[model samples]
Target: MTSPLTRNEQNSKSRAQTFGIRPDLFQAAQDHMVKKSDLDELSENLANAGVRGFTAATLPQNIHLGSPDSGTADYAILPFTDRYGPAVAAHPEPPSLQIEESGLWTVTLNLGTAGHGLAPAGSGFFEVSIYVGPEQPAGGPVRQYDFFNWRVELDHQQSFATTFTVDFVVESPGDFIYVQVSGMRGRAIEGDYTRTRLSVRKTDNRTR
Candidate 1:
């Protein structure tokens, strides 16, 4: 039997034919890669926004805003598509008021863990102040021009989970819109407090 060629020789012979090389094909490949990279970058940016975006499920405590204290930027909730009429999941929510604000639409809020000692059945209760303010243009101070806020009590029944949903619809339009979902709990499992926050964004009107 003939002896097998050495690995080095085999590699050299293989290297002699870099067959997949055509100027047009190479250019097309590069263009495709570039397009794909751009798309990837765009997708990542949106994901980052949602991951860190403000809503009702994320709002924290004390942060207040607006005239007459109409709506509070407390906590932000996701899957907003499931909010409003015909919820996919039967939302066992507390008594919610039909909210109406002005100037800004598409409100956003954020929530976070505040202290230790988790709340019972995640059903602690307290009064919260919600707001939706306008974003400062490019470089400016935090302004509440055309903003509104209000106070309401929020009850949680989502035990063994981080947070729950409390979505709303903007009955009007304006700027710097955000949401806040906060209140006092009867002390969670000694150091397990939930903190929430709010921020706002604009989107095409598709009420859920």
Candidate 2:
């Protein structure tokens, strides 16, 4: 079977008369995805090609950057899993990180999926990265990863905590900051998008 994203892409072409997904148009929005709670949606986005139909990750995650800003969902973006159905991915939705005004802040990713927390508990080829910064096209380095090769193991009913206690300086405040948590599904790697909540506890640039 082909990958969900691949299938979705094909569906877009085959079903162009009915459903049209401009996933490429909203690729920038993916950068905003980030919340440690659940990243199933982000993973699915990589699988599905109907992201434009859904809201892209944005700051103040509570508001979906499109119509229905007052929707009851507390996420900046929703993959609309109910509409398009499930993809062969880790979650029904993508990562939900928050980003309101860029700056140096702390980030903590908690693996909530007990069973398939990503890479099947011991695939031994998973990595996680949190990119922070303003919007970039689809595939540009935003901030950077906390770990070089981070992996998520079987939580066994516990949360896997990976903290990035470092400084992330953005070009401007409220510059569409975000956290990109990506992992590998076997050989094909995908990313989870989320909006990050950034903070600043001002100190000298060099105050060791």
Score residue 103 of candidate 1 by CA lDDT.
Answer: 19
Q: Which one is best on TM-score?
A: 2
lDDT of 2: 0.32
**The 10-residue segment with the lowest total lDDT in model 2:** 71-80
- The per-model lDDT (C-alpha) reads 0.34, 0.32
lDDT of 1 by residue, 1-208 (tens): 9999986666556554535445455566666665867889999977654322222222113322122323222232211121232221122121111122321234433333332233333434432233333442322224543434444333443322233223344434333333223444422211112333232332324344
lDDT of 2 at 164: 40
- lDDT score, residue 8, model 2? 65
Which runs in model 1 stand beyond 4 Å of their true positions?
A: 1-104, 110-124, 127-129, 133-174, 178-182, 185-199, 204-208
TM-score of each: 0.24, 0.30
